[model samples]
Target: MALRTGPAHAENDPATPSQRQIYSQSIAEHYDYRFGANQPFLPSLATTDTGEFINSKAFPTAKYCGHCHQEAHAEWRQSAHANSFRTPWYTRNVNLLMAEKGIEYARHCEGCHNPTALVSGAMTKGSTINRKFDEDGVTCSVCHAIQKVDTRGTGSYVLAQPAVLVDEHDQPIYGEVSDKEILTHLDRHSKAVMKDFYRTSEYCSACHKAALPRQLNDYKWQRAIFLYDEWQLSSFAKQSPLPFYTKDSVSTCQTCHMAREPLGAIPDYGAKDGKLASHRWLGANTIMAKFYNYDVQMEKTVAFLKNNVFNVDIFGLEKNGSRMIAPLGTEPVSIAPGDILTASIVIQNKGIAHSHVPEQRDMYESWVEFEVTDSTGRVLTHSGTIEPNGDLDPRAHSFTNRLVNIKGEINDLHQVWNNRVVAYNNTISSGRSQIVRYQFKVPTDARGPITVTAKVNYRRFDQHFMDFAMGKDHYPMPVVDMSSRTRTFSLGENPATPPDPQDNPLWMRWNNYGIAMLDAQQYSESVHAFEQVARLRPDYPDAFTNIAIANFSWQRYDDSRTSLTRALKLSPHNARALYYLALVERNQGNLDAAIADLREVIAQFPRSRDAHRELGFSFYQQRKYNEARAEYETLQTIDPDDLAAHYILSIVYRRLGMADKASHEAAMFADQKDDPTASTYALDFLRKHPEVASESVVWHTHSDLEAAPSHGSNAPAQ
Candidate 1:
């Protein structure tokens, strides 16, 4: 298959002179007011002092910087960031946005993908852009000159003037003058450009962590991507004094992606240094590189994908027992004829900062291919195979999220503007694992030995998506094998003695069973398992907490109270236990108690958005409009796109006689409301569409281990 190679059609034309004049006039008119007034949503281009003019002598092209940094520049030239704006896929989508919403609306995308056009006042409808900057995409100076990162997230970086020195004519000087120049000169430039903030994950969050506001998507405020937040919760983001650090201490976004390489001597930077980091920013993006015929980058991306960041294992087998299903796997055991075999395949996200498949999940495909065969190599059962028509096996275990629009239909491709709900999300989180069980009946006349093979495969784009994106273009998107495991078992052997439940630490066995039950939503069974944990470890608060949660989920309010009481007795001020107790109280009509408990939770954890919303709702129920309005306003600050908050605020403001505010809130609520037919959980949707559910596994975070107690007696109770 030959890859398509050409400059994006959008880049072929420059902005018309009339459009440029209109943009220049608009910027001149709005610059001072927008920047000086501190309008939060406005771009940094509103500040005239930043000197973003491409024609300016101080602003050098990326090629100018490449003169001295040859190796880094060469590597970057092949990276996706280099071709970000010029890619055919990007141009196709962006042009569609322009045609549908006009150039003014298209600026939303240009803010990140074509910052140069945006900052130079060339992003208006019909305006021509600087071809040089558009091709550069995220250039070296664009990233290096970032002065500050806004905690608000979503491409909130402040651009400062470039660090390079200028000659008498104010033209920027590039590279070293000689082998030995004053260290201060280079140090000044480095200090201005490479601030310490650039080394942190927060720097990447500026663009990587994005969300669509209600105004932009014409839907409720939705978090479009969350790679940065995912990393923050993982072990990789921990610094000193934080307990979740990996064995090697702290690791930043730069650590794995821009790993240091030994480069030969380059003027003032030192000789043959291994501390020089590569600018390739290699990731799982081989498709775009292949489209552009960037062989070097394509090879590096493939290598990165297969670098053992994930592990797949056939952990155990399950069968019918006195218990609904008992785990049977310490070692390989015999399987008799007519017996049902339930094999559990565990896929662990080991090293990735976010979920195994991070951003643009709708475009990619990751699945577990499982096969079982006899000695003669005759296939017994096969899953995750691709059909000639490019459809995945209907019963395969796939790690992909199914996004649906307001009409409750699949988005199909990267039609992100139409997305309303994540119908199903099965991506495994960092340092987490998902267990998928496949059951098959052993044939009565089966051969002696049976072999099981499981492989985790990843493809850059799903076939349907590729076909839609590249019409009449036949490029083979390679399916890279991320991880695999094999296990063989013989028939006619005696069933091994089931491991004594007491042999291992009682907590471990019960905890495992409890978690498995929770994952399957077997609340009653999970409660029983957790009860065993509580009996074995009386002082452990987590087990009791788990019991309470199970009972709460099961809607046994009185029973939930009993377990929550015990959990609170073991550890006073347990946030989770208190939160659930409040839920039980609210459900049982103990509104005052619920309000008090929720307030306490908020006091302890001010960032608890749930607590604030619950308390706000409680106030609204009691007609305390002022208190409810205050709480909802705080929620708006915390999460501007909170659907429930906007809905309630509309009512609260109306009751308070603030007609304008109420009207504004009502408009936002209308835009953000969930589809009336949308199901809260994918499992609910799957219940009706069993065919699709059978092939996919949706791994929601299980809360059983949230408050798991420490082993030692001296350890503090959660």
Candidate 2:
């Protein structure tokens, strides 16, 4: 059975102490948190708390690694992950952001860029470390410290404590993480189970997606985070049976970027036929990497990106510029009469890592441009192109996102400084293919041959949006065309045989294109795209439901209502659409209607925290304390670590005249223990704002750690 309560904190909850810590300390007598319970069997090392006797030298430093693994090391030296902290491009931008938002905000960027130095107590004002931590970019320790990975889209991880030891059973163990050979001298120490989540997509997401405190949402930092959520809403997730797409789909990040290589030494762990994961860690960002003189890594990254990309399949085109790749509104291949002629396109994720447009977790991009043409190469319908001002054509089917600035201005230039992406559509994950469909009436005067040309395009940033953000002249963004395909559809005596829905190219394009429109905030365009989706896949409730949301957001109230009705008629228990319907009704001033919809939403998705939270807020507005409290309490059970929920619960308790309950909830914040980096931030923030120290609970000193009686406890390092 699942545990009915929350995780026990060793120092915070005095009633119970960590058993793992106590047991290990008793066995070792002079137990050290850095080493395992049993010290490694090393002849040159002394143990216990006060004594250390390791004089033998072993292992190679990064310089020595360059001696043998020179090629690999050279590639790593220039990547953004390497110079993340000190690159001039980042330096100027970071400094600008710091001057505007203060030091605490800047830590968000530095956290990922220079994690080692940031963690090692560098990064103070007027600091003197340049290029020191930039040697390896993402060094060996950064990845190794990944103790746990959370699979949820929220992207949370547990970092491992740094400790290196040699074999304790075979030799005396000393605590120090210096060499790979030292691993053999260490005894395995297991604590809380380290699940596979650590190695999955969620692991990459922790730093990839970020959010701002509620107070800072106005600054638009929330848009900077949300890459993981983008993928979750993609067709990849819709069609994926497993957590990630399997072979029929393209391989994911683990399959390509971190592909296993032959292990020459440690075969049992990951060496299969002498193969283990290559540590090259290459991806996009070629220009920036090369700018920093890290061409080797950039070359590898460019090669990887160039080789692995989506594959396209085309059927045939019609002379009137409309192509009939398959029959619309049917699955598999069918010969139904009166079916609207459809063009089908099959897009397969062949080699890209994670998403097709990787690292676009923030900038909202990834699109395919299509131009149906005559034999003379005359233009037909075009979607996704750069306008004169260098922003994406608003009406085109393209990857979309909102652009906002610090001053609440909309920026269309999509430049760096002014570019604050409010949304995006780059959700295509590795190893997944989405079929798209486009329908056009066959003109009786159609010519014999038709050509459909498609191109996969990208832009570094939307310059127009950027201009709005920074209110200054900006540089043009670099554009890259990834892949393209063309095929001639020959007119036949009878309408072309309808291709299977699974193999439909039009649907494939539409599916991916719809994602782009949604990302770009072309709500009406997305709804129009979904209309085709609904027409093609009428049985799929999500197609209609999503369209309803698009319509609602665009303020087409009645149309949105009708679409929701149709969706419910198709799948009466679609909790998602029902919730959307409720939202629409609430926004339309039909409180009762919204309540009815919420009731249905609750019935279908009982454990939905979003539904509960929204409904609780609704009830609380009506002074329904009991109802609001019940919902909030339920939410706490569903997500106990949610400090926001606890804070809200405190308010509810106060409203109910439960002072003790409110005090307890408020105290949770008072006793908050800052993480290493966070403590440093608190110290600095308090120094600047002494008044905050008095008003808010602050924990940021050595005395704070010492006051915790359990500080010296010896817990197993996992």
Candidate 3:
């Protein structure tokens, strides 16, 4: 029988059908649940506090939680948590996996997706025990039961089943506590679930950063999902000072998703000042919410997406005659008929603090939808328009990935098992930017003063996936306009937009554009863009550093040094300026000065991976093998996957008479390096498919723009 510690509330959900009691060891009965060679879940296949399989029934369900947290539970029940496994799309995917690879393979997803079924051993072969926890999905106590976690991810968490808090004798105090007992000793209930680590981003990393290991793919390691890893790579990680924006603090996962709200009708354990962290886990899951008729959740989800989380700015126009660049829609700029225009649009991932889109990029759709029309509303050029069949136009520039298998065929079924290569991925990193230069000719007969409107739009799922799952006749999902900008160009003069608090400052907008150009490796254009930023805000030290970074990449060693000198004058101890000064000195062969600057950078920012890398390289240049080895090793400790650290360590180890360490470093370097032949895979597919290629060329032009005239043709080490 089900454990009836609490008084039943009316009747339980029909989906959670009553069934034969599932004893701890009854599932599998012989051995723990397994997946090929990788036991994806907990080491013990879920465990008691004593390290044995605990009954899934022991974990309190949402209904039990609703006895006290009525409002919170009601909110959670309507969230993605309650429906994670019950959702039709997720159900289809898991069912497909079971049919194709068997239940054992489902363990990989269940570790985070459906832990109750995972820990209960229901994922094993022929385990017919119906589980209440299965319907609960990620229930109240599932998260509360977590005792420890490893931030390396892939559901690297340990759950203690005898309740989180223990008794005086270090024994489980929570296996069968009655509702009266729990209510009387409410302190135990709070301690049972609350831990300091629960507030950390690393705690969320346990499940957010998932990878496809060799055991599952029967091939080399592949990045499957890395939301946490992307966060680490962003400015939010606070490990580097090279980001375009100033980052003052580390970002925890709960910062945005769990924003606190005032207490409602139900009481909460952790409520302070009548406010508590929300359990709704607000995110981009409109597809699930809309399909289930969750109107509140759907509205909240849409509002969250539209809350200035992204920025789309139409910045400059590249004039056809004389190739002059003018700030688009500015009062000083003029537009005329018979003129060819290349308008520059900048997209900024302002709020996400991570990748614009994190996982399985091709599945969820986000793109820049643009249209150029005359004042009379006559369309000139339209891209990213919706088709009659609910699909986006083929020519749209999307924040997605084009991945293919060995045969160069695109996989649309969210099938990671079939993925082989990534042709192109267009996700903007946190506090970063991507530039789109859209070119079109103004027709001689066109009306004057045209309007150029561009919007960053989003959809929860691709039309292809929706159609496959629900058939073509189902209602189409909502298409949200995340961020947008509209500009008007007059025949004689274009007016600039009036200043608004919500809009980015003119200087910062130019700086953002320069940063994007720098990332795109358009050194000359980046230098020009940074020059405008410096002209606009010379007092800002970051502007000078931006100029220096562009110059350094352009191999203008003297110019880089000049910019860094100006930056240092504005702020004598700026780490970014100092770091670039060292790079300029090193490249100019001023070894002693470079070392001194690098040491200062290391002193200020100890975790600066780039500082460590450059310092190691400087030591190696001076034949200081021992010092180089130590710096490289420290760099390795900071980021184990750093290919530069591995490669240099390989050389430095042999120089220091450590042959085995040298060999290991060399192998690690090779293992972490990108596949050189990977580009050919994308190129081959694009060649065979002309439509995709025509659209892709513009999107992939980030790395191929003509370099502006600079110091040297050969690029310096970035």
Candidate 4:
């Protein structure tokens, strides 16, 4: 096929009996923007600047690019990107959305999944356009043609016109040229498609992040999956002090997903120094790869899942009737058959740059499977097991989300149109740890020795959803064990866990326990745990910082300051220490000192949400309205759903005599506010299932045991 100079010829044009652009018409009518089709690409479909549809024939196919970029093409062929649109699984999801709520609603999905179809008007009403591009599914041109990126997600890329060359007037030249002609204008070709931003995380954010808008669901704005923003605020971006594993530089999306690999013999046009960025965007899509029999990709995806992105550590046990904040596996211990215990497991999001199984928490299965057994092979108790019908044990501790509709119904399906609020979320953010306390009786008559096992597991999709999408012929979706730990309880006496090669250093293990204790609000135990970290790693600064965090949270401001001083003595420029020091100063009523330390912290990390939030509150306390407004405005851009910013900004607006702005901000504050009734939803579930509730009280914490989840428990400075 030659290079296309214009729109491809219409293929079997279909006539519509009714001229009504909606249900009376075709899919083309689905594209719209109730908020006006210009800003925030979700509703806009990210069409060309003029908001005009380009014909499908305008863009070249992957095969044309594969002729030269063979290695890259081959790698991409097995990737989730290539199968984004055409896969039977994806087709079923979008097809239903189109049917249930008019085709226009599906534009929310097709914008990211099948941009070629979207920008080319293939998704709208009775349209005659070359549909061949649909097979390419996020083809080579879709990424390379990106001219600009709007990091605020939901298909936020700006695409340039399709062209292989440009005229002297800087106009796009769309016709295909022969290899000999392209070799003569290789520089022009690079200029035509390649962009520096393509190598950036922001570029990935264009499609990776998503949100629900009023235009689609007839509701207020609500965030959907926000992998990009989540990463930006994690240790990966070096933008916060929340991480346990700290680094000096920002690790972009390409750093992990599109790892560079040797191209071997194939000539890859995009190769740099004997390596090309692997196009097999390794993700949690083992199901799709197996369905398509792309074994190599499937294997790689599984390997990625098990490649130490997260770790599961069965730390300790809490004897029932005698509650102890997981003191960790330190020193020898004793256990008896008649005793009931609560097993403590710590799940650390160690190396992942974003949340584990990010962006698909609502669909993917990620959970902690806990089991206990006796020497006689008698099953004591198991929380996470597959039922005969393929459903997971409903009470399993899962690292997933539950987005609810206005009526409080759970939308397990990936229906973007139905999302209203995050009713439940337990996904561990990067460099964070989650604690799962499972309590069970030891069985008085059971065998002496008890073996306990816990694992972090991943499945591409649950049985129910897969069955719904695939219909009668249910294809098997394999489960991947991401991380696991096993411990044994002896007859009368049990030694601490024997050191393992895979375990974190003893000091770090103690620190992990301390972090978990802080999350559970066991301040004395948390402080004791951090003190152990200090004793083991006296040279490490974070040990002291950890102690300070516990003290600060416990309201021992003087003791907190003492630890911070020691931490600073070890590392003068420790940002985490300095950030915590600021918190102490603010708590002690030293506003000026607190402001200085916060300013210094902000200088090192301009994107620090905590710094901006605290600074804004400080200024508001000093009654410096202008300065406070600037900080709050900056905070709003960093985290749009911040409750404090919305509430305080509403007051700031009124103080500035902007009554209209104040009134509007008040509504956002209410909208973004956490649903007090959401607590009742979990209570209702517990009431219905007293059997599960009787095990023990469960505490689910999101922060890395930070003193404050976001802002400190202290209300924003009056």
Clashing pairs in 3: none
Q: Write the per-residue lDDT of candidate 3 for residues 1-718, one digit (tens) a residue.
A: 2222433211231112222123443443554445433343532123334334455666667787777677788778878888878877787877776788777776777878887777666777766657666677888888888888765456677876636333444444544446666676566566667889999877787777776554455555566667765665567777676677866777768878888889977776557799888788888888887787888788888888888788787877866744545454333676788887777888988788678787656688888877788767677776666666677765577888877766777767777665667776777788888887677777788887788888888887778888777756434777888888997777666656565454578777787788788878888978898899889888988888888898888889889889999999999988889989998888888999999999998898787888899999999999999999888888866555567988999998898899999999898777657667666777777777765575454334221222122222111111
Please provide, for model 4 over 406-472, each residue's C-alpha lDDT reduced to its tens digit, 9 standing for 90 to 100: 5555566777577655545667777777788777777788886888888888888877788878885
lDDT, candidate 2, 267-352, per-residue tens: 23323465655655665665455445555555565556546376655433222333342322222322222223444444556454
lDDT of candidate 1 over 1-718, digit per residue (tens): 1111222112221222333345445554434322234442233222223433332222456775666567777778888778779876677777776676556555567667866666665655444444567788888777876667743455577764454533334333332222122243555445445668888887887777776665456655666777776776566764211111244666778888888877745431421345568788988776787788888787778888888786665656665421233333344365787877777666667678888677547767788877778787766676677655665554566777777665556767677766667776667777655677666767788896888878888777777777766774444566777777786778867354555432234464565556555656778877997897898899988788888877888889999999989989998987767888888999999999999988887777565567788889999988999999988888765556577888999999999999999999998887657556556544455665666764444432111111111121111101
In the order shown, what is each candidate's alpha-carbon RMSD?
Answer: 10.5, 16.9, 7.6, 8.0
Better of 2 and 4 by lDDT: 4
Q: Which prediction has more favorable lDDT, 1 or 2?
A: 1
| Preferred candidate (TM-score higher): 2 or 3 | 3
Over 4 Å off, model 4: 1-47, 166-171, 323-330, 443-449, 496-498, 636-718
Please tell me which predicted candidate would have the highest lDDT against the true structure: 4
**Residue 130, candidate 1: how far off, in angstroms?**
3.5
